[model samples]
Target: MKSIVTADGYHVPVLLRESVDGMNITPESVCIDVTFGGGGHSREILSRLGNNGHLYGFDQDMDAIDNLPEDAKFTFVRSNFRYLKNFMRYYDEDSADAILADLGVSSHHFDDSNRGFSFRFEESLLDMRMNSKHSKTAAKILNEYQEERLADVLYLYGEIKQSRRIAASIVNRRKTKSFKTVSDLLEVLEPFTGKAKEKKILAQAFQALRIEVNEEMEALKEMLTQALDILKPKGRLVVITYHSLEDRLVKNFFKTGNFEGKADKDFYGNLNTPFKLVNNKVIIPSEEELVINPRSRSAKLRIAEKL
Candidate 1:
C-alpha cells in the first residue's frame, strides 16, 4: 500500500487503490499511465514495480513536466495519449502489460486562474487548451463558430437543453463585443443561468467549450482503438472517467470491443468480444474518499482484460 502525495496539489489521483489494483501489475510488468497529470498514480505504479519493470507517463500539458518523478525506470512522454501507439512503436515496445488512463482534468488546471478552466475567475481569459500550444481557445469558439455549430457543441457535448437559444444569444452578443474573457461569456449566459443550478449549468457550458477546443472525443476514440492493438494478451486496461460521455465510451469499448457497444452473438449465442470485463459494476470513490476529495465524486473506474 503506497501513498502518493502530489507536488503542490497538482492533482489527487482518484480511485488510486482500485485503479492500480485493477492493473494486476507484476514485479516486471510494463505499464503506461496515459493521463499522467500529477504523477500520483504513476508514482504508486512505480513503487510496486521491480527494477526490470518500466512505466511510461504521457501528458500534453506543459505544467505536468514539473511533477515528473526522478527514476530510471520511468519515462516521461510530453505528448497526448492519442499518440500512444506511435510513441510505443518509436520506443520499440511491441506491447504493454497494463495501461491506465485517468481522464479527469487535474485540480491544478481549474485552480489556475489564468487557464480559464473555471468560470469562478471572472476576468480570466477563455483559454481552455489542455496543451497551451494548441491554437484553438474557448474564446475563439465562442466568437467564431456558427450559431448551428455552436448549438451542436452545447447540446451534444454539454447536454444543455437551451443550446439553440444560447447559441443565438452568443452570436448576437459577439457581434457587438467579441468574447475575450470569462466575464464576457458569463454576461451572455446570464439569462440561461437558473437560480438553483447556475453553477452546474455554467460548468457544463465551460466543459463543452473545453472539449471543442481540445477535440477530446475524437482523441479518446483514437486512443481507445489503438489501445487494443498495444495491449498484450491478458493485459489490463484501467480507466477512470469523470463525465458520462467518456464513461459510456469506455464501458462500450470494454464490453464489445467497439465504441458502438453492440454485442455480437456466436454460434452458441455467446457474446464475442476481444476483452473481458474485470468489474461488471463500475468502481467509484468511497464515501471516505469523497469527503477527503470532493472533486472525485463524479469519477467512475472501469477495468477490462484483453482476451
Candidate 2:
C-alpha cells in the first residue's frame, strides 16, 4: 500500500480491498476501473493481475491523468466513465472480466481549495465541474438557473427540504449581482443554513451543483447500462457509491437491470434480468479503514455478476 498521504494526495481509494476483492481478479483477468481518480484501485487491481492480465482506467480530470502510473498492463483513457462501452469496445475484443466504479467526487476535489468542491473554501470560485472541458459551472447554475429549476435540483439531488426558499433567496440575491465565489453563495444560504446544520446544508447544496454540472445521475445510468452490455458472462460489476441517490440506482440496477427498480419476469415467472446479486447486503468500510480514511465512512460497496 502507498503512503496514506502522497505528494499530490489525489484521492484515497474508498473500500479499496473490498471493491477489488469483489471483482475476483485472476491471473489473466481483463479489468476496467471506470472512475480511476488517484489510480489507487487501479494499482491494486494491477498488483493482482498476472503477466497477461490487462487493466484499463477511465478518468476525465487532467490531474488524475497526469498521475497515472506507467506500465504496459495499464491503459488510461482521458474520458468520463459515461463512455464506458465505447472505450471498452474500442480497446478489447473480449468483454472485460470485471468492471469497478467508485462513484461521486474524489478526495482531491474536496481537499483542493481552488477546485471549489468544499464549502470550507469560502474564497474559492464556485466552479465545480469535474472535467474542465465542461461548459456549465456551479456559478453559472446559481446565477442563471430559474428558481423552480434550481429548487428541483436541490430537492432531488440534495434532498433539501427548504429548496424553494433557498431558490427564492438565490434568485433575489443574484438580481443584484451574479454569484461567483463560494462566499457569495454562502451569504445567500446562511439564513437557511442553521448553525447546527450549516455544514450539512452547504455540503448538500454543493453536491446538488456538482451533480447538475457533471450530469452525474444520467451518466451513471448510461455507464451502468453499458457495463451490462460489456461484461462477459458471469463477469463482475462492482460499484462503490457515496450517497443514497447513487446507491439506490446501483441497487435497483443490480437487482433488475433497470433504473426503474422493476424486475421483469419471463413467461415462467423467472427474473429476466442479466445480472444476479453477488452481495445481497451493502458493504461499508471496516473499522480499521475508517480510522485510516474517515471519508470512506459514506461509501457503500455493491457487487453483481452478469448472468
Candidate 3:
C-alpha cells in the first residue's frame, strides 16, 4: 500500500486493520474515529459500514481535515479528540456503537524532519507542533520552562532518568544562547548521556518535548473519559496505544475505573466495573505485520465493551 499524505503534509499508515478489528460494527452502527491521522483507519471503517452507518472523525491538525471523505456517511471534526463530547452534541449523537483511537505520530509528522519528531533530523527547526497553527512550540517549552517544570515533563512524560540534570543543562545553555534546533539541543545533552546501545538519547529528549508541546497525556485523559461517556451500552471501544504510559492508562481504566484498583463490592456484592474487557490480555501486532511496519512494534491494541 503506497503511503497516503495527510492534509497536514505528512504520510503514515499504522496498524490499519488491527486497530479497527475490535470495533465490531453493524450496518447501522455509528462509529467515531477520534485520531483521524491519515484517514487510513477511516477508510477501513467506512468500507465496513452499510449505507445507513455514520463515521465521525476528529483531528486537531487542520491538514488532517484534507483527508476527510466527502461522503454522507463520513464527517471530519477538526478539533482535538479531547472535546469529543462537545462535537457529538453538534452532530446530535449522544452515543456511538463503536469508538476507535489510534494513538501515534503519523508518518507525515515523522517523515518531515522539520517536524522535530526524529532525532536524526538535526538542522531542522525544533518545532514539534502537530498543528502548526498552535502558538506554543517545543522550543518555547525547552527555552522558557522553569527548570523544575521542565524536569517534571522530562521525568513524567519522557521517563528520562536524568530529567533534573537535563533540564538544568538546557536552562544553563539557554542563558547565553537560546536553543533553536534539534542539533543545538542534542549536542548539549549528548555529553551527559552519550551514545550507547541504542544511541537514541536524542529520541528520549525529543519525545519529552513533543509530549509537552501537545500535552498528549492531558488530552488523552480527557478523550478517554469523554469517549466512554458517549459510548452506547454494549458499544465497543478499541484503542491502539504506541507507548506503555498510554497502554497503562487504557488498560487500567478499562479493568478498573481507576488505573490501580481491585473490583470493589458493597455489602450486597455489586461489582464496580464501568466496562468489561473483551480481550483479557493486550493484543500486539503479529510478527509478519511487524516486519512490514516496524513502527507497529510498540503498538498495543486493547478492546472493551461498555457496561
Local error of candidate 2 at residue 281 (angstroms):
1.0
RMSD of each: 2.4, 2.1, 2.7
Error of model 1, residue 96, in angstroms: 0.1
Candidate 1: lDDT over CA atoms? 0.91
Instruction: Indicate the residue-level lDDT of 11 in model 3.
Output: 52
Candidate that beats the other on lDDT, 1 or 2, i.e. the better one: 1
Ranking by lDDT: 1, 2, 3
lDDT of 2 by residue, 1-307 (tens): 1113456777667888889999999989999999888889999999999889999999999888777888899999989999988887787545889999988887678878998988889999999988999889999999899999999999999999999999999999998998999999899989998899988998899999999999999999999998888899989999998889999999999998889889799999998888888889889889998888777788889999999
Q: Any residue pairs clashing in model 1, and if so which?
A: none
The TM-score that candidate 2 achieves is: 0.96
What do the candidate models score in CA lDDT, each in turn?
0.91, 0.89, 0.82
Candidate 1 lDDT tens digits, 1-307: 0112345857677899999999999989999999988888999999999999999999999988988999999999999899999999999889999999998577788888999998999999999998999889999999899999999999999999999999999999988899999999999898999789899899889989988999999899999989899999999999988899989999999999889989998999999999999999998899988777877888899999999
Top model by TM-score, which number?
1
Candidate 1 segments exceeding 4 Å error: 1-7
lDDT of 3 by residue, 97-182 (tens): 99999886766777777678776788888899977888788888888999999999888877888889988998999999998898
**Candidate 3 positional error at 78, Å:** 0.7
- Alpha-carbon deviation at 296 in model 2, angstroms: 1.0
